[model samples]
Target: MSAAAVAEQDGRTGPLERPAGRTCRLCGSNQLRRFLDLGVVPRCELFLTPEAVAAPDVSYPLQVWVCERCLLVQLPPLFTPEETFTDYPYFSSYSTSRVEQARTLVEDAVRRLGLGLDSFVVEVGSNDGYLLQHLVRRWIRCLGIEPSVNVGETAREKGAPTFTEFLTAETGALVRAIHGPADLVIANYVYGDVPDVTDFTRGLRSLVADDGWASIEVQHLLTLVERTEFDTIYHEHFQYFTLLTGQRALATGGLSVVDVELVDIRGGAIRIWARPTECAMEPSVRVTEVLAAEEAAGLHVARGHDGFAEAVSRVRDDLVSFLIEARRAGKKVVGYGASGNGNTLLNYCGVRPDLLAYTVDRNPYKHGRYTPGTRIPVHAPERIAADRPDYVLVLPWNLRAELLDQLSYVREWGGKLVFPIPELEVVSPAPADRPLEHPVF
Candidate 1:
């Protein structure tokens, strides 16, 4: 974005600038191409206090880059982990489907790995005991390594043993030394937050026992491209991964991919299983199959994503046009979730309160605060029913199944829900209010 536009939005006076170009985070290759640019956006998770909202927010260039050599797609790491995670407000326990997903993972791991009271488990970015709490109930010795001090404390309060620190090589080894190497190491959605994939994967390797398995879950780059999920491209996520690039990232730390599982959550994701290179099993057929699919989709090369930027812009334009038409038709549209991806979509399309009005969220921490960049007011979910708006825009579109059921009450007053990404669609709430499926981002 130009400095003039930023100045008008955030009340800044001076000229704004951001650095460009960097080596690939995985291979350190200067041979990289930018595939998508979301323009200048603030850190999405950085919610503003009432006072802070009155001040201008610092923003950065939101662009996606791909390495020619390694085929790893990334964002320039302009924001540090400290800037992104210190007082992180996203608690994983807020979504019931997500908690059930965690429980299923624990059950599967316990059965497959023969976990018992003596087995030790570790989770990086374990927010509010969403996963480890189930292990604690099973009498499994587990520890949570969390970066956010606020949510880490909540994990401890829930009887989940949590250590507040970002997992680096030293910190991972330190945790291993103090609590012993883990039988199972689980990382869900944290890989995107680490700017240095080499250090983070090494940390994952150091934390695992010789014969143990580590499962890292991240949104698949192929799915991102196919679905046009540009909203997921934010400052907090340093990179996007396919099985090929993902394996390269693991090998940096002497870990080898053994198998892969694709789950229908967060647009679509991969549950990657790896072990130390020496003891790692032969690659599973699933791995071969997924790699084949990615290759067929032209995702194994840097230029395969050539038209992603245009697709992203098309979605942005369509949504903006729809919202503008709704406004002219005398319709009211309020957002349903004050989510990070939602903020990306909002700011990229230049949707201010005049376009979105106030939004609602399930997490209480955001109730009185405002979304970063867009500065949209957040309220409790109950506000939707009380206000009876004509439309409730679903920001977290990945939670479509659950949200459809949750917002079914909107149908009481003939109100509808709007989904903005992939394509613009406005529809009545789910008719039956079905139960939530056990899938989560």
Candidate 2:
């Protein structure tokens, strides 16, 4: 289920009190060990308008812990879905790469499963109908179970049938009873924000037909640690999954993992294809291949993340010094994307408006707003062209390919793009002399 759907199911917001001790959300284990301590950080997605800057806001310990029992890297559930998704700012349609990815998934699934007009498909966390819109084009019957009323309405306006609700054990049963079992169930990047893993998996179980498949994509923990992608650890993301641990979580609700694929999206992610236990076949070679890779990386144990805390510190120090030196060099460095990743990176490094000035985003909802904790103002992409800053610190660095063309104009003023994650690298973008077929921003 989407975070909005879960938040809508129970109107009660999560308690703000921090628990003295917490068992791993993936397993009922008391042997969790802390490896990364980012200190108290505000919600990454909670962008504040200029007027809301002075409002009292709550922050939580942005820490990561690995479970000794199951090795699920996770943050304590410090937030309710309501706190994050009710008016969620992340619209999947904003990224062309994301929409294309969704289209590819729908195309492949339709061809593989032979989905037709009689087939019913359900996409949990279907923000703005980015995926279901493709299914609608193919005339396939589908429903988008979105949590955010604001986002889901956009889906409806696009002719994608979207129900603004969260997924739960009861929610799934109700949907199945009313709308019938789904031929395929898809949840893209929704697991990270869900507070209740077992119940939510059960909801997925109830929604799919006995022979139907459920496809879930989650952040690959190995990629996160190896690439130093610590910015993904936010209050809303409750757990990070390894193949072994993800298999365990799925089994909790009678879903068996049959196949898996590693994809380069959202930094890095894994697509797990599962089915009801009774109809599940022998695990695919792909599943074992991924598990072996995780084993080779020693991700099956907590020790695999041993040096990551130091690596995170190094990233922060490197980025902070780079910005300070750039400022000392009398260079202007603004940000490219006003995204959650940028917020986590900025707040962790104690960056303020003085160092960053402001960042620009394609989303108008964030324009005229301040980043949640850092208070860095966000404007439209055109701001860069007007100001002609010397450098652009790419915040949503994962989408560099998609954004580079749109930002190529920055090079007109000898502006370079800076990437801070995996390691900071300053790269001159596309040729300033080259003309764009059309302006994107």
Candidate 3:
């Protein structure tokens, strides 16, 4: 989810509206404490066109609470899958880096799992068949289970056969009828977004072959708080998982982690490889180490909510001051990446077009559209070269390295790019100078 404040066009859920007192969605803890109240925010994915900007829009509460019971951080309930996914507009192929990552992951799965021509691959939330497109190249058989009609249709059009519906136990049975069993399954970034983790994993179990493996990538919870990734908290992401909690969730669904890989992609990510408990792949020492660390930190204990609330306040104030100071200096500042994280950052900080000129995104669908709430217009990356502003404010700071490399020309005229959250800083490259190392946090 790119940081931005807009409604997710697919089937978005409705607000919980159960009058505050919410038990922790993960561990059944009533000791839930409120930390950040982003007011009512629209789905962060729903970018409005310039014309639609004039129309009134819907908004929902974006409050986040930490469960003392499970140390699980989550947003207050808002929007159902029907409201979020049914009309989803996001296409996975929009990002080159994402496509590359998908391709690489598919390759790794094939090699690690000994997948061959006879193997079957099933993907959950497989938008536009981004990874399947590569799997097909290897002459592998594949099926994509996508809930969104628009994206599923595109995946089918791309030649990877698809089921244009969400994966559930029922859907899994239907897929089993047609595809038999999948030798490999992928749930990249899907597990956390799903509310019914048990059902979703049940569907996965039904689809996977008896000895097959499934790889799920989720944002590592430790990394989220350690890095001050408040922007990652949004309505769509249901449960933040560390290896400890994730293993528990998977075990409940009759799966076990056989291996784990910490990836730098998506800020910080963990790709867990799992199979039936009968499978004998040895769990890595890293797994126990991570689980132990989480236990010591009381991830399952309900306490320390107030400290997090204070941290949220500190981050919010610092971000606001950074943007305000930049604007007061008469510097021309624009945002980079209109992703959902950027939206949460902007809205939470109360930033509007008054501070940022506009946002730049590589995704064409967002270009020329207005960011929800702030009315900041989204434009193509070329706008940076053409406009050549004094400063560029990066919303998806996790990708600052990639964006900086891509927009190195900003240094041609001494233009520097700014990072907001975590901390604020500028990167100015001399025309003939090599890349500079960002100050290590």
Candidate 4:
């Protein structure tokens, strides 16, 4: 039986709720082939408290599949949008690197699009007004549509007009009616979280002006499979897109890609510049180049999804062995970055408080809470200095450089860093005599 059929037999909703069989979200194709199954995992962002941990925590199957028709990588809808993002704890402004990326994008958009005081910019899923706040500072008219009430309020406080509502076709029409069509629509890192990809793209088409363009950034599927980025495979991310699948998803909503840029953020990301289908603008050479690269990487076929299960299994076994050896050697191992990806990795590997003593995060909201499923206590960065662990497991390995620089003090005590993903390896601290080697894990 298919995964969806199994889910239905177990009285659960599968990834695609279809009558006949599971269908692709982008293209209504039921030829989905299951690739990797990460077992049941809780929502990555759902951090628990001491009281909540004592109670039952919910979890769902974290399986991934690739559509034969469009080759879109996706997970079944294990949780509703309201369940995942209503009072979300993640804030984009909390990370200096993320904030800088947003500011840089805003500067480029303003210059490239000739955005003036009259230009209206609308950002879908604008968390804490990180990007739109830059526009507000330049005295430009802007609006943010954030579903999370807490993050929306923060955006409002930062002087960016925000609507705490999920962006749907209806919401898009409503925004267009009130603020008129947007000159520039930004959907940074929000595309993957959208459950209904078709409706979200339609909303984008509705909210954007005829001449306006939409900029979307989604983690690349090539990077996910090649780098064995299993930690990013959480219930919150409904679909993983390659340039081919991304173009297919956008085309369903009367949008066409004009340019595509490969970025290093979020491990590996593709920034797509799309315009209305009716627009006569030809796609830039960059778009063709990216599509070619995806084709060469076997992303357009089922082969691209192959070997992923084995890769994830190897990482899991290696990590578990590394942790076991560390504990056996009388070393204290703790984690840094109490992030959603960290939660996924910890829960997948079944690493409990016994294996990973604790973790520290800069986000004040998660300081006193515990990680979902694993129930590892989260403390502030200052706690790291007090404990002085022998090995600090860098959970959010994507931000290794920034985190390494921030926690370099661990080097003073001869503490080393551990990266679980890509491979299990221990990174030695930089010698006091010279600059850090910055070893690539």
Candidate 5:
């Protein structure tokens, strides 16, 4: 069967009717070339109870394709936004580093935009109002639009004026009617989650003042391929963007890229500063330079997506092999951080409790639950010291530095750290007898 037919059969259409073919979401092109397939996996966030874990969980094909015409890499929506985001479990405030990053961005935006009490700031997908809390503290007028009722209520309790509704073009108009057009709109790491990119950008354009700007951050596709960060691919993330694809996606709503900032957060993300085409701002030279780099790296062609499957396969093999060896050697191996991406990696590698005894998470909500698909028990970080596993596999490799420091006590028991991305390697502690030549992983 054709991809389009399969998608239609699976009930993947958005509110608007997609073109007949499996068209590109950005440019409406009919040329989408499939590249990497991660096989079928369960929803990343479906933490199950011991009773539910024994029952079969739903799974969907986790295949990715790049649009030949627009270079937008995306996965077909196997599940709807309402099915994925409503009553969401992932909260942004759980990570101190992430909260600090949001604060820094809010401070920078305030200083750069000359925001004051009169200025209005609106954020889409504002999870628990992590960023809006900073704006409220400055006594600035701000609002948060979040679809998840649980998180939105938490945001309201935190004193951020939040509306529990998805930001569609219609909702954007309503916001403008009541709150007025915002001086600045912020969408952090959410552009990939929406199924309708055009509608989401149109909503941004509708909500922001003509002279105001919208800042969006998305995981860089280049980094995904280069670092083999396939674990980031889950059902919740519908699209991936290079600078070229991002510009095209935004331009669909008459927004133009004004500036670009490469951030180290989320393994390598691009923060795009965009303004309506009517807002007379020149595009930054950095935008041109980044596009040049992408073109030079052949990101404009399908061949750039080649070899990604092989790279992912190698990581899967090496990680499984390492865990098997550790088990055979009678060493206890446990995972740290029961994150969504970690679930993807574990499910893809077929790692179960036999290979990895359990995983620990700092998030209280995830603690005492079992990871989706793998059924690995999730425990509090305190369990790690009590258990003193021989090897702690750090699942969220992007936050390795923070996790390693927080878990430094593991070294006291001669425990080693293991990371599964880029390559699977066991990081040994620095010898106490000599000064370390490199930072401890």
Candidate 6:
């Protein structure tokens, strides 16, 4: 094929070729190896506005590589923060679960850290102040470092006291001059979105006080590989992290991890707590155990690569087969949860409105908008009742249990629920007043 044709096929700005000479992001090693190449895909958080939808869709190549030295799994060269974060549309306040989770986290932090009026809490990439708002109400002095102007303004209006600029070393220095070091730095779900570990962590170290702590929530790479959660591999998520990689990167930036907690909030998450050297808490056994696991799993080398790719193939075949059979049987099928994972699965598997009429989400931002590349229209939860589909495909399979519990009303019509990941299963919802025998997932 011509170079232009290859570039189009790869969904990148240039031709498909191996990155040369440059060492790994964590460790300066040239032993990097190729892993999964997800082809060209659109940015996961770039939710299309109505007007933008009428224009051409922008897409880029999404190829992941494994750093032989540090075992960090990350995407190849892509856009910078300026290009990606300007007027970004994804807002955290849109989700009830997230808001509640943030509130709980703030409350827990206050109790655990002995945080009170004297402590200052700082949040990185605090989108729309979902977490900081909780701190504000608790009478704790908090500042939110947000990049997106639209999201930052919205949060400021909500009284988050946010700064509408990217958090960098220079920005951190400026903020420190005004507010001094912070007692807490929240890097929730924003760790993976950042491409540069050196810069981001340096900025984090500077903003946090000697006695302060930093808590970061990142998606577990182990879960991604084990569960075949390929849908999480999108443009926005620059890296899929294991504890080993995270620790190494943090230590290099003069921060030490004191604790690591496994959380169920976002599919599978690792909430890591860190502080400066003198105030560093002893690293938890979980941290060492995870690193050992990754080492044993051969994550540092190009191993277990085939199984993941094979699993993706099986999922595609199984889903397509199931959909065709259901259509042949004259069953109306629809999808649920118009999320980033859903978008990746739909676009990669070539699922469209034909196989599934539409998808639903609780977030209003995504309601009237369509999925990035697939053009699958997003509707509110009420549409599920108005046009009752025979089978509802749970795109965000991680939250299947929660969605099923809330959508148990569909069982009144004998409609069944479907989970495409792990495996496909048909579940009949329990009566409205009755409890479900099986959990939501």
lDDT of 4 by residue, 163-240 (tens): 999999899999999889999999998899988999999999999999899999999988887889989988889999
For residue 100, model 4's alpha carbon misses the true position, in angstroms, by 0.6
276-348 in candidate 6: lDDT tens per residue? 8777877888878776776777564454443466677787878887778777778888888877888888878
TM-score of each: 0.93, 0.92, 0.88, 0.92, 0.92, 0.89
RMSD of each: 7.2, 8.5, 7.4, 5.1, 5.8, 5.7
For each candidate, the alpha-carbon lDDT, in order, equals 0.87, 0.86, 0.77, 0.86, 0.85, 0.79
Could you give me the TM-score of model 4 versus the true structure?
0.92
| Superposition-based RMSD of candidate 3 using all C-alpha atoms, in angstroms | 7.4
State the lDDT at 364 in candidate 1: 94
Worst 10 residues of 2 by lDDT: 432-441
Clashes of 5: 0
- Candidate 2's clash total is 4
Tell me the lDDT of candidate 3: 0.77
Model 1 CA deviation exceeding 4 Å by range: 1-21, 432-441
lDDT of 5 by residue, 177-246 (tens): 9989999999998899998999988889999898898999999988888889999999999999999889
**Residue pairs with backbone atoms closer than 3 Å in model 1 (clashes):** none
Cα error, residue 408 of model 6, in Å, equals 1.9
Model 1 TM-score (2 dp):
0.93
